[model samples]
Target chain A: MEQFIDVWIFGLGIATLTYAPPLIFAALGGLFSERSGIVNIALEGMMTAGAFFAIYVSVQTGSWVIGLVGAMLAGMALAALHAVATVTFQADQIVSGTAIILIAAGLVNFLNLTLFGAEGSPAELSTPPKPGGVSLLVPLALALVALTAFVVFKTPFGLRLRSVGEHPRAADTVGINVYRMRYIAVIISGALAGLGGAFISFNVSSYTENMVAGNGFIALAALIVGKWKPVPVLFACLLFGFSQGLASRLPFGSPELLNSIPYIITLVALAGFVGKSVAPAAVGKPYVKH
Target chain B: MTRRINAEAILVPFLAVIAAMAVGMVLTYLVTGWDPFAAYGSLIRGAVGSPSAIGATMLRSAPIILTGLSVMVAFRAGLFNIGGNGQAIMGLILAGVVGIKLGSLPGASHWIVALVGAAIAGGLWGALAGFLKVARGAHEVVVTIMLNYIAIRFGEYLLGLGGPLQEKGSSIPASKSFETSAQLPVFWRPDPFTEVHVGVLVALLAAGFAWFLIGRTALGYQIRAVGLQPDAAEYGGMSVTKITVIAMFIAGAFAGLGGAVATLGELERLQKSELAVIQIGFAGIAVSLLGRNTAFGCLFAGLLMGALDSGAVGIQNDNTLPSGVATKLIGVIQGVIVLFVGIDLVFRRLSNRIVGVFGERGGSGMVKS
Candidate 1:
């Protein structure tokens, strides 16, 4: 029994850490964009871009850091297209986001095929980089979340971003350059989302097709369930990560159905059986400044 | 004024298509270093150069049109139903169940019954989200997105290993081949291989029905009113909640029909894994946006998109370009088209101004939808 307890603890701990970084980073990405008045449903697409670039560049450069930078840049570039539509052109944010998802899937896969001749596996990272069995990215992820909380709550930029999201007109009245702020926030969102994707690729040692899977959407759900706050969002991600981490081990009728737990939890949270989600007032609405 | 509006409607989508295709051509050139004109020529040939290709394109349009109409119905009611794909799979699963189980029904009646069964399943799934919006104030967009996953997992449960829906003696998680009676009929085959199925007609008639329903019916007016001014609609004795629920139901039903038609007319049996994360539903969003959420608009847009998809397959056989690049080009074009369509106001202005250059009134092009 003592051995089982230790095994369970070690397994769950590893699984939890494994699953948490991507969700945390992506959620933080979502927080920045939403707090600056953009509905970024393109996180999934951005993650795909990030994952594709991370593996491709890492394989080519033989350096994880270079690959990580490439992934972030790729995500930002995709997000820029979204920003051009939702921010500059003042298009329907949802449509713009949906378009990004489609474009990313097609473009990344096509590039993968063209570049690697196939989705060839990269170097594996099954074991943690540190001897203590901790992924270096996990610590970075936690630090980033804390930094995000500080940036969102205590900084002038945070105040400005929140004000813009809360009331764009009011923010514009205060000479905030609503579009510029939103564009910057959205690009930053893309970069962090890209980092989240980088974590996934780095963890696995190689990127698979659709490797980001629906985790991007899962992070988006965590963002909403966390009430758009930084710390709470981290906890929400960890909770989801825990469920997903232990899903295969759960003695459910079918392991496939058990995989649905994270999604089900998100639904229950959204169902308002608990507390209702209050989005940033100007979310999903394009800012048409005078 | 109406004539101008009509002309503008046609012109804008055409311009968007032209601009998008042009960009697609350039991108293809940049990426694959292939000749853009030849690539497009191959695309057109693949889409409609032969009787078989045209028939294939038409058959593909049936699902796109139905799903486009699905998004159109929801948009009219001020709802963004992102779960068109989810709703479609529900429809497919229900249709499969009815097709397999309803053995007693006559051959002629079997397909109809299956179609209706699919629609109802889809409608119910859709209505659940609408109900949540009214009862719990859960945003439909998020709810629908989340609902998509549930439906997908539920589908996986029903069809995976030891799943209730899996066929006997089959290792794959797929249903048995549908009975002959359940299949949609194919009309005059212009070629030996070409089968022009009844689903194409069903799509057309549905488009016609949607047009009449949205343009002439009291329900459509109420839906539009609720969408444009929910408080005013409520004040005017139209139950905003009821309208929202009904609109979602109808939208879901159309997508259900899309799935049903695809199953009944196209595939011999329902495959579980393919049904999960199917792209047809997301493709519907593009169709709806490009179609301007109008019934006739959906028909043409469906055909155009169907041709592009068909052409994607068609271009591959030509071997002038890498199959990978050719296929990706279709997706790029589709994505660009939707991106352009998302900025509907911009294109409307561009198209209207182009028209104004030819017209005498010097139209300001200031009108908003």
Candidate 2:
């Protein structure tokens, strides 16, 4: 009984805490972008940029907090490009998102190679603080969820944002600056995604190529599964995190197959096993103010 | 009228490519602080300076062309089909299985059977996405992306140590070497090290087939109608659901063939590690966009992309930059190309302005597609 509690309870709990925060940060980021009527598929790329810049900055300045700021800035820069392309130029959101992914992956890895050389980041570097065997980001992520819920549900800014997403033309007539709201939402999403990326790199104490590894997509899935609600998204992320923890601990089955459980669940959820997940009416459609 | 639109189609991608290349040069200068001209010079030499270099470009071009065609087919039916990587994995898995287990088949027939099996497996994988989209109201983009990860995990499991497809008694996370008869037939030897295979012809043939299917068939008309206006097509008595499934199947087949050709042409067996790093699916997106989503355009764009990749190898060999930096730079340029092409409206105006300089009326009579 003691062994079960130690192995299954404590170990799994710690693992879930470690993995779920990044998803929470990123999924919340998606909520912001999508709520403003933009399909931020580039969350993955933004997260990738965040992952790299976090470590690179932390290593350069010897301050993990400054590293996080740099990560957000990098993500915002990419998000700004996404905004310019999708909102200003009226480019297809998915195409622009795909471009951002390619650019983030390429540019980040290029910078990593040029800056770090073949050796990669230095062995000893500053990392996030851990309290009670859990990274501080875990509590921070949960707090953000509450904050997001409040901001989105109770705030006027949130109402305007959702209005723009649901009916931009209607919001436009009512005097909401649709473009500005979208741009701000996308940039905020980037900042949150960057924080998520930083948490991943900080946990590992280094940034490696492909470290972000589809977590952004999983967050997008979480956003859908959570029905675009903060509390439900948190549960969805925790469920995915739990599956990951279980996959790692399972002693017998094919680990590769086990590793695919989260994705399978995501597929099932997206396929409407849990119910219909409808997006904002204006989501994925470029708004043209006549 | 159609001729004029075709001119714009060709010109837009051309301008985008030039603009993207300029951006690449600027990025190269900003990042490396090296002479961009010298870097490009090395890139050009690496891509076409020798027979082997050209062979390398052709070798690289083959798989991306098929994947490009795969994307093009789906795009014509108004589906993104981002699941090319997943479909290709399914193809390669089945192809690998056939190549290893069905060694008793006669010469030429063995390889043919393997390719067919790959196409079927990939098609089924692709059709599943279409089915989900139509039947379950799930978006293809998310479904396909999820499928890519699932396929990767499945492939890893099949080839991982103690897995079903692992080489018997070898302890390597790979399948057994394919029978020589199952390998793609070599047609030319550009150099002792570079063996040009029939896979290049296969890609070309696939491109031709795409052209015929999209341009010369009633089914193609229905697909285009559904893509252009699904409700209109449905009102016109065409089944959007069936066409979508068929289009996805065709797209999957092309990508599957791409995986098999690359595997059978280059590697002797399937490695677990290669499944994760397959860039052909994403590269197909770049190729399709640059090619203007036309079958022949995909062929040319794929070749150009292949050349750029080979040129990166040249950059490495010349030591102009640190090793492995050039490929990443190529990736950035590819991304830029997609960005420029995605916003082709900006490029269209730019192209019209450029044409206006040479005595053609600028934008007065041009129609947006």
Query: In terms of DockQ, which candidate is strongest?
Result: 2
**Model no. 2, DockQ:** 0.75
Against the true structure, candidate 1 reaches a TM-score of 0.94
TM-score winner: 2
Tell how far residue A258 is off in model 2, in angstroms: 2.5
Q: DockQ for model 1?
A: 0.60
Mind giving the per-residue lDDT tens digits that candidate 2 earns over A163-258? 999999999999999999999998999999988888889899998988887888888888988888899999999998887778778787887887
**Can you write out model 2's per-residue Cα lDDT over B215-313, one digit (the tens) per residue?**
889999988898899999999999999999999999999999999999989999999989987778888888999998999999999999999999999
TM-score, chain B only, every model?
Answer: 0.93, 0.95
TM-score of each: 0.94, 0.97
Q: Please report the interface RMSD of model 2 to 1 decimal.
A: 1.1
Worst 10-residue lDDT window for candidate 2 chain B reads: B1-10
